[model samples]
Target: MASIDSKVNLSTIPLVALNVTVRKKLGLYLNPKNIMGFSYLEITNFENFKNPTNEILKNWQAQRSEASVGKLLSILTEAERTDVVEDLRALIDEDVRKYIAFMEKKEDPPVQVPEVDSCVPRTPETLGLTVLDDPDGLYPERFDAFICYCQSDFPFVHEMIRELEQTDYKLKLCVFDRDVLPGSCVWTITSELIEKRCKRMVAVVSDEYLESDACDFQTKFALSLCPGARSKRLIPVIYKPMTKSFPSILRFLTVCDFTRPCTQSWFWVRLAKALSLP
Candidate 1:
């Protein structure tokens, strides 16, 4: 069997090998808004293209030809689109997989991965907080917050999970993709989670979020729980800048503006503080 180079660029792969639907989905997922870090093919650099996937591939070949297929796979995995990642992996040639496996063994132990932001507190001590003793309390809440977001903004939601749940903050968030049980009604499950299970609600604000009827429903339901914004249970986080006017309902409430560079350094801390508050 001919050995494949571990460093083979994604651009060199035949388009026929990349399914059309998969290619289109990749193009969407690889957009700068969805992906964090420098390794991705920046779709913004290309303009006036009828077929974005083709253009993205062409540009990747011309400029970032050194980027490996493994890097592409890594990006999709980071985006938390495991289904898409699996589909892409299935399309990889057997020789390429063997080469990747070989390289994985030959490579040195991985370096300590850096936190997403140096400014964000990695431990509860750094944030001057202790883990909530929810179980011991009367009428203990099951979750810190129920994350309300559009499907398009899930990458940001994934980041939220990392900062809140995965870190020392150890906050349990009820996210639709992860928490909702299968074969259950989404509306019923979401309502129960928002009203009963979660103490607070986080509305991930973006252009796509504004258009989503499901997000609207979630936000409204959360608001009804705490009428007149008296409890501050609803937290609106603006991850992406919106072209449309901000929702009238959320306008009066304080927002965690992640879009602003000045606010980003303290965004997670602020959110964590808000969720932890009684």
Candidate 2:
């Protein structure tokens, strides 16, 4: 680094010459352990290199001299250069460090993305988190939710899921978290499950729900299935603040229009109470 830092790419030949020397010197220590000469072994050992290799490689490759990223960082005032490699050696050193760490962590079983705390960011596979197998390898034991709403109503339905989990309603409520990976592949499985085995349906209604494909499918499914053995199982929760009026079909069920209640503190209590009763 000291030998090549100032002259890096003032001439490419000097930079290449410096890297060859560094790589060879690095190989002397690395080669002995693997029984090959001139092998570039990382000083901190492989175990330390486990988890972050690809990310580091990505960062390193992103900073190589040919890239605009390197040029941009080079021009920055010292104080402003926060997320940059600074120079090629620093980038290489970072990659070597990450590579070593990744090797070290490699055998520890891939770290799973932590279980999402609330179902706000839930997916069919993620919500169906446990790796239990069906003969079909589809359904997990506990993820039975039917998310019913218009595409237009997902904004409110998005907020409603957060509020639902605050209660001990016990059922796994799935209002697709808009903030998670939007447009994820998991929706295909969710679409299948809702079409097949869902019992409880939470419909976030606006006039849009009455007009939309998602609403038409879910509500018609609910109205047809939610009777006799099913009883009054469909919960039509209103989202629009402008209107309290419901369509003649939906007017019969007890409803909570989020219009005023969503703004008040007691709304949570009332909402909790309503959810608690049925």
Candidate 3:
């Protein structure tokens, strides 16, 4: 294996790993017109360029020379690009893990790995966070809910999975991206999961959800299984602020709203209780 640099600049790693699609997304969110305090001319120039993503990233690096990967991740998270943030986080974690393994095998004294942020540690022992996976393979057959969400709201969905499935809630979720088998009819499989496989359906409500035809179908189908939410089968979670009114069909059903600051503390706990098996 090639020698690993002990004093690696963690900031550059994610920028280097970012694919074209992710870069484009970031470029849109980080554009000066979208975000305040950025030079209008500079961002406008980058936007008109053929490779705007690279130029935007380069500008960001120049502006915040000391900023770490965590800063970039935060920006992505704030921009509601949690999917990208999660991907970059995984990449960073894997890179750190590889570096740690390499250091362990060396005869030299333990090299101090630079800290990425408060969440990621400087030491090897603390950094080895347990992977959240079903080791015994028992939970595969059972799922608490089939999470209905659009691609844009996946960050909130990702956080929901972490809190509900990975934590003490211990509830299994049927997420299309993670659980759906390949080479199948999407509509057919989705209908089957909502109707039979999962005990409940979690509709991650947002402006995006309101616009998605698939989400509309899933919500309606789940409601059909249990009219008037008699068994509390469909849970609509208000994940983001919306200009559009709540779905008229689901207006009668109680919603778990995460947008409110008061609910943020107990949002997961409340959601877990609702998802728990009877």
- The window of 10 residues in a row where model 2 has the poorest summed lDDT is 10-19
Pairs clashing within candidate 1: none
The sequence of per-residue lDDT tens digits that candidate 2 reaches over residues 165-255 is 4334433455544312343354444443454445456667776666666566666666666554245556667656535356666666766
lDDT values of the candidates? Answer: 0.67, 0.45, 0.67
The CA lDDT at 97 in model 3 is: 53
Writing each residue's lDDT as its tens digit, candidate 1 over 151-208 gives: 9999999899888876666777888777554554567667766776688999999889
lDDT value, residue 78 of candidate 1: 79
Query: Residue-wise lDDT of candidate 3 within 1-278, one digit each (tens)?
Result: 33235576555443333334555655554443333235767666555544455556645543555444556666666878786655555545555555445445655754774545854223332221112112222112346799999999999888987887666666778888886646555676677667656899999998888899999999999999897689999998997789998889998998898899987898888899998858
TM-scores for candidates 1 onward, in order: 0.50, 0.40, 0.50
Candidate number with the higher TM-score (1 or 2): 1
Error of 3 at 130 (Å): 24
Report the Cα lDDT for candidate 2. 0.45
Q: Against the hidden true structure, what lDDT does model 3 obtain?
A: 0.67
Off-target runs (Cα >4 Å) in candidate 1 are 1-141
